[model samples]
Structure formats: structure tokens, C-alpha cells
Target chain A: MPIACEETGRALTVRVEGEIDHHAARQLMEELSRRLDAALPKSLTLDLGGVAFMDSSGIALVLRAYRRMVALRGSVTLQNVPDQAAKVLKAAGVDRLLPWNE
Target chain B: MKPVNEAKLTFWSRSANEGFARTAAACFAAQLDPTLDEVNDVKTAVSEAVTNCIVHAYPDQLGLIVLRLRLYPDNTLEIVVKDSGVGIPDVDQARTPLWSTGGADRSGMGFTIMESFMDAVKVRSRPGKGTTVTLRRRIARRFPG
Candidate 1:
């Protein structure tokens, strides 16, 4: 899995590619944590456009990111979630907490 | 055992494999006349169960993770995920929500997700032996629009 982060003003956009499963979840979390710690953006936007698949492990990642951003007094948004991934997220009621575009 | 119209794959005990497993399950379920929602649920549930095995089953040694999927004649799909690693000490506590033995971050939601999405989920484990998770989903015949 590859995660690229770009900071546009106060919003930090993260582009995640590949699968987000148990093995890859930790690495992705660590990367996000590190970047969040360093950049400390006021808002975090995740671009899931390139994400091919996501499991429950992906939900944990999303929850962790959401909570962290909330603690930082920031907001989290998801964009371009795949249909399969969106289904899981919606089932988990994650969409209720995090706003998503398409 | 010969798989009944089934497909199997093995991946390194890694997270990327979880994605592979989910995609495989989705594709396999799509072969039936189920809606996209049903297929997604099967995929998510399988992924959750498999991910649990990857995270908890093998701690030190990295071994093979086997995903066996079979499409039954009754339009029911069964997925069996096995890991020959350290098994769960207590099956009861493991299934409890927020009862993670892996500290705070881990919410112990794996079994919960499995139970929620699939029609049936069976977990068998023995400490120092291994772990196997069986998930089943039945797809109802869709009516033509």
C-alpha cells in the first residue's frame, strides 16, 4: 500500500492506493500518524479514489483517523470511495460520522 | 478436499492480503444471482474474519494463510479461512465486543463484523494449535425487474 499526502493550506489530503487490510492497516496508520503529527493540518481529507478494496480493517483505520482528527480539533472527509468499500463503510455507520463526496 | 466450484489462494501473512481476500470473495459471490449489496456484505465479512486471523493467529512466525471458498448447490457460499498459528485462548471473550486482549486501540470488532454481515459464522481455535473461521452467506434468487 502507498499513501501520499499533500498539504493544501490547512487541509491535508491523503491519497491511499492499494488494499487496506490488517497487514497494511498498521503501516498506513503509522504513516498517517506521522504525517499528522508533523503537518498538524486543521483538516484531513482522504482520497479513496485509487483504493481498490477495503475491509473491516479499513474501518478501524478510518475510525482511528477520524478520532485523531477530532482530537486535533479538525474534521475528516472521504472522497471517491469505491462502491464495495462504500458498502462496508455505510454498513458500519461510518458515513454518519465522516462526510463523504461520491 | 476438492472444492465444489470453488477457488482458493494463499497469501503472505500481510495486510495487503486482506484486500485480495475481500476482492476474491466479492467476485466469487457475484457468480451467484445476488445483488451488489449481498456481494459486498460477503466480501466485508470474509475480509474481517481473515484479517482477525492475520492479526491474532500468528504473532512471531509468519506462516501461510489459506482461504477456501466453495459455492454450494443451494446458492449458499461458504468460506473457510485457516491459519496454523497461535490460536485464541478463550473463544468466548474473543467474540465479545470491546473485549480486545490487544490493548486499547483494538476494539475486538472482528467477530462482530462477521456476525453482522454474514448469515452464519463459526470460529474454531485451540491455543498453540491453530485457528479456523468459517463464514456462510446465502443468496436468494433475484426476481427480474
Candidate 2:
């Protein structure tokens, strides 16, 4: 699996270890939703450190999680975003909305 | 006049093909010796265009998507992504941010991303014909300002 999740305290940490394109996003959505529903944590922290690239598909995935977290009255944090992926988020003017670290 | 270099790719409209499409376009543009940032911009544009085709063009079915990459004599790169699926009814509404027919998974920022990453993005579509997105960007060597 390209996605790994762990429930640490009040935050659900998800580490994606590959490209975040459409193909990967599909599987990611399933896993993420399961975790988000299984336990409604106060926060969802996505470690994009391992993501080599991202596109609108990845952005779509992030948006899905963001919406879910919002519904749960939680927040989403994107950490260690790669340059290519960051460029995509910045172009969409969403670098701030996601509360990214790098 | 013919372009200095060009490549055309046709792939099945599976969600899996989106990343392949982007990497392929980036490799094609790499021949121009563009800056890493320029290459990233092209990749982002390709990603948005191709994702739109897979998600919107054939919303319920699978189809073929075509990508065309051409490098001109003026260091400008042009990318064209086309799909034979359903066409957009209103290109204007489709281009708006957060305006999505793709339900929950889409950001509705496909056109915005393409336009922001590339110099220009033009869309052409008819009711049942399909949609074609043309993106052009001029890459230049960095100069100390």
C-alpha cells in the first residue's frame, strides 16, 4: 500500500509514500475515509514528505480530507511538502488553507 | 513553419494514467533545458488538463485522451490535452474556482491551476464533440535582475 495511517493521540497521521496522482488518490481516498470515519480525531496530519509529485488529483484528495475534517470540526495539516507538489498547491492559491509546514 | 520538436501521446483515460501523462510531458519539455521550476510548471499544467479529461470528459465511462507537446523556435512549449468524452456546457463556469461537477473529490481548480502554471490556457469544446485544452509557456534562462 502507498498510504500508511496511525492514530496518535488526537491526530490521525497519514504518510503517503509515492506519487499523489489520480491512480494513487483513489486508494488514498478509501484508506483516508476509513480512518477518518473509524475515529474522528481532532486533527489530520498528512506527511507528504515521501510524495515525489502531485497534481490536481492530489489536490482533490487533500480537499476531500479537508472537507471531512471540517465536518468533524477538525483541522488538516500538510507537512514536508515537496517542491513540485508545493508548486501545484501555490498555483491553486491553497498553500495557506491546508496549514502546511514546508 | 514546423515546430522544432514535438511528441504526441494517446492513452486510456484511466485515473492511473494521469501521473504517467504528467511525467511524460515533463520529460518532453526537459529537452529544452528549461529551469526546474519551468519543468514543474509544465508538469502541473499537464496534470490539471489530463485530470479534467478523465474526471469530466467521460464522467461515467472510460475513453481515450491525447496529449501533444511541441517546442517552438522561441523557447516556448505548448501542450494540448484532448478527450472524446462529454463536452463542457459552459467553459466559463467550469473554469471558476470550486465550481465542480465531480462531486467531493474535485477541487474545481483544474483550469485555474493550468492558467496559473502556464502562460495561457485556452479551451475549445462543443456540446457532444469533446474538449481541447491548449497550454503555452515560454521558458527562459534566469537573469540577475
Candidate 3:
């Protein structure tokens, strides 16, 4: 997985590309959590435009991020979610927990 | 239903191989002419089963995983994922969502996802031996005569 992030003011935008599966999610969780702790952004936006595939593991990562953001009194949004990924999220009922940006 | 097609896939116990296994299964089932949604369901379930093997089965050492995909004449797709690693001691507890032996990083919903996506899921395991997970989903297609 290729992930690039930039911070503007109190928001952090993370652009993730490629397939997000169990293997990639492990490293991604660690990296994003570390960045989340440091930046302490008011909102975290995950841009999934380039994501071609995702599984339940990807949903777990998003949920973890949402939990962390809630702890900091912030929020998280999922943007450009692929159709297949969106189906998984809907099945898991994660679409209700977090907002969709696009 | 009688099986019309079958495939066996073997890979290392590495996490990077999880995606490969799922995509491979999807491709194997594609010959049955399953819809995209059905294929996604299969891919998602395969990922969960394979992830369990990588994260829980052989966390310390790399092992081998055998994945099988069978297509029945009735358009039913059966996916089997087997691992010769540390087997689950308690199958009941492991099936509970949010119940994980790993750590907070694990969502512990692997089994739940598999059961929800597939029509039927059967898991067979033995302590100190190995574990095998079988998932079946009937595609909305009929074999052309």
C-alpha cells in the first residue's frame, strides 16, 4: 500500500493507494496512529480514490482511526470509497459510524 | 451439487500473500460467471480466513497455507483455506466478534465477516495439528448446457 499524508491547519488528509488488506493494514495502522498522535488534527480525511481493493481488514483500520479520532474529540471521514469497499463497509455497518466525504 | 471445476493454491504464511490469495480465489470463481458483488463477497471472505492463518495461526514463524476453490455444477463456489500451524483451542470463543487472542490491533471479526458473506462456513481444527476453513457461496448463475 502507498499512503501519503499532508496536514493543513487542523485537518490531516491521507491519500492511500493500492490494495488495503491484512498485510498492508498492519503497517498502515501503526504509521497512521503515530501520525495521529503527533498531528492531533481536528479532522482526518482518508482519500481512497486510488484504492482498487479492500477487505474487512480495511474496515477495521478505519474503525480504529475513528475511535482514535473520537478520543481526541475530532472526527474522521472516508472519501472516494470504491464500490466494492463501500459494500464491505455497509455490510459491517461502518458506514453509519463515520461520515463519507465523497 | 457436483463440482465442475476446482483449484488448489499454496503460499507462504506471510501477510503480503493474503491479497494474492483472495484475488486468486476471485479469479478462480470468475469462470462460474458470478456477479461482481458475489465475487467481492468471496474475496472478502477469503481475506478473513487467510488473515486468520497469518496473524493467529503462525505468528512467530512462517508456514504454508493451502487454499482451494471449487465450483459446483449448481454454480456454488466453495473456498477452503488450510494452515498447518497452531490450531485454535476453542473454536466457539474465536468465533465471537471482537474476541481476539492477538492484541488491540486485531478487530477479531474475521470469522464474523466470513459467516456473513458466505452461505455456509465450516471450520475444522485440532490442537498442535492444523486448521481448515471451508466457505461456500452459491452464485446467481446456471451452467449453460
If both were scored by TM-score, which would come out higher, candidate 2 or candidate 3? Answer: 3
Kindly list the per-residue Cα lDDT of model 3 for residues A1-102, writing each as its tens digit: 488899999999998888888888888888889889989999999988898888777877888999999999999999999898887777678889888977
Report the Cα interface RMSD of each model, rounded to 1 decimal: 2.5, 1.5, 1.4
Listed for each candidate, the true contacts retained, as a fraction, are: 0.41, 0.74, 0.59
For candidate 3, what TM-score does chain B get against the true chain B?
Answer: 0.95
Docking class of 3: medium
Model 1 agreement with the true structure over B1-66: per-residue lDDT tens digits = 444598887877776677778878878778787887787788778877777776688666577899
- List the candidate 2 regions with Cα displacement exceeding 4 Å: B142-145
Q: For each candidate, what is chain B's TM-score? A: 0.91, 0.95, 0.95
Q: Which candidate is the best by lDDT?
A: 3
- lDDT of model number 2: 0.86
lDDT of 2 by residue, A1-102 (tens): 788888988889988888877667778888889888997999999888998878787888887888899999999999888888888877676786878886
Per-prediction backbone clash count: 2, 0, 0
DockQ, 0 to 1 scale, candidate 1 = 0.38
Q: Report the lDDT of model 3 for residue A28.
A: 86
